[model samples]
Target chain A: MEHLDYSNQAAWTRVSGDKQSPVALSDSLAVKNDFETTLSFNYDHTASYVRDTGAGIEVGLHGTANIGNRPFSLNQFHIHTPSEHTVNDKSYEAEIHFVHEASDGRLAVVAVLVQSGAASQTYDAVLAHMNQKETFDIPVDDIMPENKAYYHYIGSLTTPPLTENVEWYVLKQPVTLSTEQINHLKTFYSHNNRDLQALNDRPIISSN
Target chain B: MEHLDYSNQAAWTRVSGDKQSPVALSDSLAVKNDFETTLSFNYDHTASYVRDTGAGIEVGLHGTANIGNRPFSLNQFHIHTPSEHTVNDKSYEAEIHFVHEASDGRLAVVAVLVQSGAASQTYDAVLAHMNQKETFDIPVDDIMPENKAYYHYIGSLTTPPLTENVEWYVLKQPVTLSTEQINHLKTFYSHNNRDLQALNDRPIISSN
Candidate 1:
């Protein structure tokens, strides 16, 4: 019930560091409602990516994500390098995150794993906007992909202050890109990844 | 941008059957930019554990969660069984989801993996409410443990019509509960799980 800041040291410590406590699965947090409006991806909202001061490429992935019947608009895409999650003790170059939210206070995200690949239109859009002199939104309509199939699960934060109770939906298959795509990303965020943490004996469910 | 109901047969068929068509991560369809609260957790509010229609017993090990500088709140906990995700061909009993959101459309979640353990106070809170006959919040303030360490990553929906673009934080270590807790969960919802889908070559990262 208490509100917190993005940089609240104490609160952040509690959220990013509390791993010993048990957490209940809040059913109310699930996306059980229908969104009233429809939103589409804006391949043109190109903006510079910046997390913890590191700069990279970012594009908006628009969509309508509803919760409790209230619709939230999803926007923006970014990546973390070195993979924050480990599957059977394996990690990858980086992971992509799509952020979304509803009008009343509902959140939903669609995450995709980025591995070594060829040049991807999405990545290209991000790269075009990568520059120390620029930090603005761009148009991404030309490069946005059209695939929607995905895998869903509920997981925790991969970073420190390991909080629990987040829903996850990973795509079963990845969109294809060229090797150039991976290299382009690496150019901006060569090591933009968190290390692999322990599974903590948790099971990941595939929402097929 | 077009708004769509997830259950709409036409929408489902349109997006479900196609692989190449762009399932845009559209944000306009759903409501966006309404919630504006911090992302944090609270234990007091998570007293009433409802056997989610699908997820089994969800014990609120920690209190409500607070996101980074947002208005939405992380209310409670829940779980998915039989492994919705597979790291490298392995699975666990169940996964716990700690959901959170902010008022201005910011969302953050911390996920923890649970294994079989001896019955403890945390499990008792959940088991006590397992009957589904009662509908009230539980009192789990005393037994809640501290979770300050974890791994963080960004991911998406773990189910069908997988949405993209969200942040993720998974704890490296899994908290423990008694085998009774696991059994108690199973007694109520035996087959409430999703199968593990293909990895799709997605790279997982750890926020360690």
Candidate 2:
């Protein structure tokens, strides 16, 4: 197999191959890696959670070609207090993660920047439900737009063990939420952000 | 705080709270027990990949919500030949996984089912690219759609330590792919699937 060239955007097509081992035992013992992917939520795509707090994708939205052509069904979404990647040592107030995977084991993620701004139409639906202070659930399909543009790259596990080889798709444009929405997130996660670590030997590729 | 109630569906909103944790190491671990809510794509989302031969999600294109969320942006997805899940006494042909994480310290995943079928759109895209084969590399902002409807639960790492407390979101519905697509996947990984282990008394919650 050829070594992957992180600088080449087109190289992703060639590098997309399976690892001999699906799970690494050694990586598991390294407790320093505190995060694990192991949760599921089933709901209508149009529903929203009152406790939604500006984090998490609204449950029940659906998308095509979003999951390697397998058609990924949307679940719920959440936010990371403080941003994960620091642009020049500066992190944002928070980062939004849109996690998805295909039935054939093809994974994809859409990262959106969450900045303080006026209420965005995209976010108003969710914010409205949040303000209700009552039992509220809305379908994501009802609120989400149909834009499918994004950024992509190959990187490591940002957490511990920092596993390398995972694929990444970061959005160049950010989805909007309001200042009040951001503050609401802060209330729940006053300082939920994690500090930015060194890039190490990770390679970041920009599709644009 | 009130413990999350798994039995009632309508009561989800009243019961679910921000439940966001502070900067505690264990709190950070809270991410380990949470579900993801966004859809992501490979840097080469447009480029296609072979879908491994098998009975389920790995056959063509699939989606995973079982991806870990936090510390790193959720990246591209792939599958393993054979299968990681076990049945009454047998395993399937293969399994698919959606990998995800952030920079600070969070990880999550979402998995789906791939049964036998005809050729899939994903299969076509991946095959065309593989035919023009080259090295591997990840792209930024590949192809991302705003879909967030999914099923959320809690389970152990499909891999080792077989760590527990992993927040899982397995979608109830699954997309289909073709036999040709499945065969194409066999090209790169014929036996990447893992054997299913014990459930370890883990409770699967339908976070609808």
Candidate 3:
């Protein structure tokens, strides 16, 4: 990974490659309701990575998903403040990315948006353990929205090496968090989000 | 210095800080003809730095300049394909940055835009030595334009740490290079330039 200052100009070049990218997510996506599955996570404080921009708390997960006949097991998960992917061009306060990988090394990421609102028990539990630097088990379902609708597309990693051709599934509905919880997260990561890349004429399929 | 990939999106974030920034260059700068001085450089092949996006050939220089009573000595110089700074919103194909520093650590950068047209003997010499990885000496005057008109502003380095409050002198007149020469440089650094940064409501002094 390149030493990248998320807050610098070196992070604002064009997205290249012949592949399609960052297609907008609206209600026009083709719905696929097969994403339903149970995922388990263990909060490992030491697994967190820190940069000048923000902190990425890695969560260990145990589960798998089958997208388009390709099975991807949950590899790891991390958090990004102010979100990376946008929904209809609107960004959220935070985002949770569950990175999964297939036996052949293909990747599929599930993104859950977080917005400021009522306090979330899941977030509270995670933050409490995070503050203590202790380990705890969490049911991924506890952090997901009741609605399972998502927008699917092909995009690249937000960080360096920016490997392309990853399958993306961004939830349409956002989970809620208290303003205080949001502020607490910000205390760890002030600004750690990448600017939006161009769509490059890609299509975003909505799980209607 | 942070590991930076100029060809990626990590190179495109807003320049932020409490310090002043590079403003636009219009026809309003107070021209000081005192920039006239002799600068000598030896193109030591082993003095080059390479990255994924491009290569920076370090040129040793000897000279000094005074902008507003602050004296800055010529430090080193590098090249960027596709100009980084824009002149009144206009950008060129490429740019050369001559970085200068004061005893107190303050910086001043002199930028010379590169365009495709007539063949330039200076560029040809530099390119020849660069291709052969040999050492050669160049007179700074040979690469400068007849018109010393420039745009002055305060901006940060397009790369990382993005230290602010650097004095900038962008020559309004551009130097020419042959199309083949431009293409050759591009072959090494096709997309190694940072996107134009915002003026941040700062004033751009046009050196009339």
Q: Assess every candidate by TM-score.
A: 0.38, 0.36, 0.41
Docking class of 1: incorrect
In order, candidate lDDTs are: 0.44, 0.40, 0.60
Ranking by DockQ: 2, 1, 3
Order of candidates by TM-score, top first? 3, 1, 2
Q: How high is the lDDT of residue B32 in model 2?
A: 29
Deviating ranges (above 4 Å) for candidate 1: A1-208, B1-40, B58-64, B68-72, B86-90, B104-107, B131-147, B159-165, B198-203
Between prediction 2 and prediction 3, which has the larger TM-score?
3
lDDT of 3 at B154: 61
Report the C-alpha displacement of residue B120, candidate 3, in angstroms: 60
> Model 3, A44-117: lDDT tens per residue?
33323222322355555456665443456776676778787777668789998878864434467888899999
Q: Which ten-residue region of model 3 chain A has the weakest summed lDDT?
A: A45-54
Best model number under lDDT? 3
Of candidates 3 and 1, the better by TM-score: 3
Q: Any runs in candidate 3 off by more than 4 Å, and if so which?
A: A1-23, A28-55, A131-134, B1-9, B12-208
